[model samples]
Target chain A: MSHLKHVAIAGATGAVGVEMLRCLEQRNFPVGQLTLLASARSAGKTVKFKGTDVTIKELKADSFEGVDIALFSAGGGISKEFIPHAVKAGAVVVDNSSAYRMDDSVPLVVPEINAEDVKKHKGIIANPNCTTAITLMALWPLHQAFGVKRLFASSYQAVSGTGAQAIEELERQTREWAKAERKWDDVRLPADQVKVYPHQIAFNALPHVDSFLDSGYTKEEMKMENEGRKIMHHPTLRASVTCVRVPVFRAHSVAVSAEFEKPVTVEAAYEVLRTAKGLDLVDDPTLKKYPLALDVAGKDNCAVGRLRLDCALDNGLAFWVAGDQLLKGAALNAVQIAECLV
Target chain B: MSHLKHVAIAGATGAVGVEMLRCLEQRNFPVGQLTLLASARSAGKTVKFKGTDVTIKELKADSFEGVDIALFSAGGGISKEFIPHAVKAGAVVVDNSSAYRMDDSVPLVVPEINAEDVKKHKGIIANPNCTTAITLMALWPLHQAFGVKRLFASSYQAVSGTGAQAIEELERQTREWAKAERKWDDVRLPADQVKVYPHQIAFNALPHVDSFLDSGYTKEEMKMENEGRKIMHHPTLRASVTCVRVPVFRAHSVAVSAEFEKPVTVEAAYEVLRTAKGLDLVDDPTLKKYPLALDVAGKDNCAVGRLRLDCALDNGLAFWVAGDQLLKGAALNAVQIAECLV
Candidate 1:
């Protein structure tokens, strides 16, 4: 972990990419040099890393020439088109998109849960979904304690997961609602003026978090099952999830009822979660305290609270977990994977 | 069924009470005469009814005199204090509060599955929890078809359920954020000016919905188990729920994964829900269509979509349900219960 490596981050101007840069600095990652890459539109941009300016380069197949590790936070299409080039250029690629997640050849790594999986990566490792990674931070520790078999989860996903545009939309619409400048009845905004989401997100909940699948579940909803099975190494593990986009700016929160093969008591689950790495126990009902998005917005560790028995399922426990979706879900997880590699 | 009856609505100045007024007009409930009652603060306030002004009378022991039926949407304290008075005045009371919900003598009603439960009410009938009611609107119908035994649900509750002040707070903070009037550090506002909710409701998710109980579950979370048993007539029916308050202004949505005694199929569940009363099936995966808060905000019927089999549970099916929390979760459910009595 002490050996320095030259690293390049694609989509350097994007939200997750920026967070990746901050995470690398905050964690004091051993970086010999940093390369920032973006589309030609952002080629001239400069990002400050370690109090030094790093000019953004136009992302191209040749961009990975001198990079030992390439972290890609760009869209799936961009990763699909360029990740192979990075691998071919002799750089290990860590992709934060769905492009290579389900690929048998690519390992999906969450350092705490499956760091060893990274060793098997064929030059490319896929990052789990933001919501799934945050949830597994708490669930994996409990799974080790209780042998979890299945889970039912509902996510309160923040707008930042949709990118910078959606965050601005929430800010814009909220102001509009507050000023009463736009009554609910006046629906005549121009196309450019219309915000990120299909509807105003100021004071609303949208059930459609991602694209819908043929099975009626959104892609975000299926990620838990698909990615969970891959990460947990449980081919038969079951998951029923509903992903909702809330007005929250950052952090993703999930309420989960996980059924285990063995009986799970709140005390035992608490013991495991309290000491688990990257996890915090916030389950104090007496003080009216628990893990809330505001409390975990910029934190590294995911908070787990509201732990109890699932009254409906035998040997099942219900809990609520919150984590900075940008950190644990994307940037931090990617950096952790890089750390495990070195 | 054709006979009209004089109906009175208590707490006419409240959030749900106003929604009840609109629902009655929207559904065209058979009404011979209408009475609106409120506290002293709202007494003499004029509300429109059938294009005529009806002045609110101060709710008193005698307010229900000659009123054939009464819908109570006031807080528990008011319901506890005046529900008996309304009953003594010869009107059946359909209460939308927890005052009598868990009482052994009271019948917790959801018209579609438990309309018959109304006959068992001892002068007062109780509406289920907003989250429970909305989730069960879809689950109960499927339960009747599949013999449901257990459920795991997470609720995305709206701030409106907290009452009008919280709604105002969400709007206010959003506007404040939009205007950039206050950074996250500016905290000089007076305590009274802080407005509804213990924390800011804009751009945040609060895991605590209602006050917490000794058992660590919120009163809002336990409503599903306590009220669910009575409404479903399955004293042993199990439920594990995590209730959360989002910044949404109107609708309450729930993600439900229910397990039944018999084998459940998405096809069969779809068939049952397609014809279920008080529910609209809005599932269309390829078209990216499904139930959402924005779509169900001002509507009466609960909108259900994103239906599928639980990949995690045998004999389990997962679905998403949303309804105007103020309407079906409170006012409309109470009015429908009153309609059943007449």
Candidate 2:
């Protein structure tokens, strides 16, 4: 376990998969061997890892034969089908899909919140949902300082959270919009161009992020509370979340109103968040500086800003958090969990 | 007042101002004469109203001489300076600026919520803030049925709410990003190109919508509770609002968790929202149909959708409401208030 580990990334051609490679290389994650695995379509695609062209292999049940840590980010279905195989092949699986996140046997790990939970994983360690993970990067730190009771949050999610194809869809739509020289009033992307999302994502905001449950909350919306409780080890943490996909290409921003067991001040929250790992406090409203999605894109650290005392609830604080959904929300967090393994 | 009143639209060149002209024309406000007023920079510019070229005059203290109804949208500063003169000249002012909204003497009106309040105004009738008006359009109906006590809201506000220059800034910055052909990972507009906003609004979300208050909520954010209490005639009503400026050019959307005195259900909410004036119930998530910003843009009616029972609070309902910021939020609402006077 002390030696450099062999790492295999499933869905290597996807958005988060590619970022996982970068995080491994940038953070110098002591990888003895790196294997890139994807679907048959992207099998031969070459991804440059540390200036070396690593050919992506077709992901199969045998993909984790000699891999020590297999990172899965394809989708819930792919992770469900192959993650068990990775576990059977004696490889620890760090799954980025929601397929295994809620499983009692699987440890939902956000390294900063519950790194010790990584040690308790039998075979698979599930990566928290991107929105949930990014939120907890700040929330977990605050929860440590003041016991958090519940939160009401709304996410301004990005197109990249939908995967590589959705990113392409947004880019294509933006170009189509530019080509038409349409005024802002006529900015709806033509019906034919809006494929990835239900409606146009060019300049619109979609309130529905994931599939809706009978409770009327989207799966993505409930993931914040579901995953937050697990990651923070606080079973009673209630979260009412509205997941919205905005026009941004990368990075997700969340506005949260959290009520705590003890009274929380903006200054105290700032002091606690300033020293928190993998998070930066960027709350200066006078200068009009806060956690903006465009600025946080491609960055590892999640940024928290717009810190204020909630006017609605006693002992409540409202804040805005921005993080690269691909990095802190997905890849970088996954790789950091792998780092905790050895 | 009844015989085809003369209408003067201050800030007639701005986004909401232009929409005011459209609303007056579309809604057939029985305009005998239309006067367009703006700053000296746009003094001679001709804006087409009812297919007639109406020249813009500088909005001076004496501009409301022959005007019967003055719809002011220039800004708070201009309204403060010139509105007294408009009232002095015997023109009833439907002020769109926040200058007179909270004034005990000025009637802050949302036509749908309190059209009766228009009769109570001495001279100036204040228009509610864009986000607050859109939210109250839906909330008022539910409040009637269930008796709302408080609400926690987050707004996905469009750039048009910041006026015409901010709209242009978004359009120009978007074009800049498109021309650069930047990929999703590198999707930031150059720092030098960002203006009109403290941060770039293209493909990004800014949490700071208006100037911050000592309480940490932006002036724009607090307007909901402040204006809601006035418009709804409910002094005890509490609202915690987060106002965010998104890349969209028009249409402001709000996600609200409203707690009421009586019990609420999804069926009951739909029934109320469907019959509510100036609101369209657009809540069918199964069909992927909801109140989208793009669809709601340019539409006179505010759309309420994604109706669900709140999982976090007792007797609470969660819903998403979107409206054309220029329409129900400003221009059309102002025109409707003027209609009340007629």
Model 1 stretches astray by more than 4 angstroms: A182-200, B1-6, B26-33, B181-195
State the lDDT at A230 in candidate 2. 87
- Chain B TM-score of all predictions, in order? 0.93, 0.98
Q: What is the TM-score of each candidate against the true structure?
A: 0.94, 0.98
| DockQ for each model | 0.57, 0.83
**Total clashing pairs in model 1:** 1
Q: What tens-digit string does per-residue lDDT give for candidate 1 at B1-342?
A: 247878888989888898888878877888888899998999988999789899999888888888888889888999999999888988888889889999989889989888998888788898878988898889888888889888888888888898876766766565556566654323223345456776666666777887887666788988888788888887888788888888787888888888889998888988999999999999886665778787787788999988887777778888889998988898888888887887
Per-residue lDDT, model 2, residue A110, is: 88
Q: Write model 2 residue lDDT over A1-342, tens digit each, in one string.
A: 549889999988899998999899999988889899999988887988888888999999988888999999999999989988999999999999999899998999988889999988999999999999999998988899999998889999998899999999988998899889998778876679979888888888999998999899999999998989888889998888899999898899999989999988999999999999999899787777788898889888999988888988889999999999999889999999999898
lDDT of 1 by residue, A272-338 (tens): 9989999999988767678888778888999999888777778988889999988999999999999
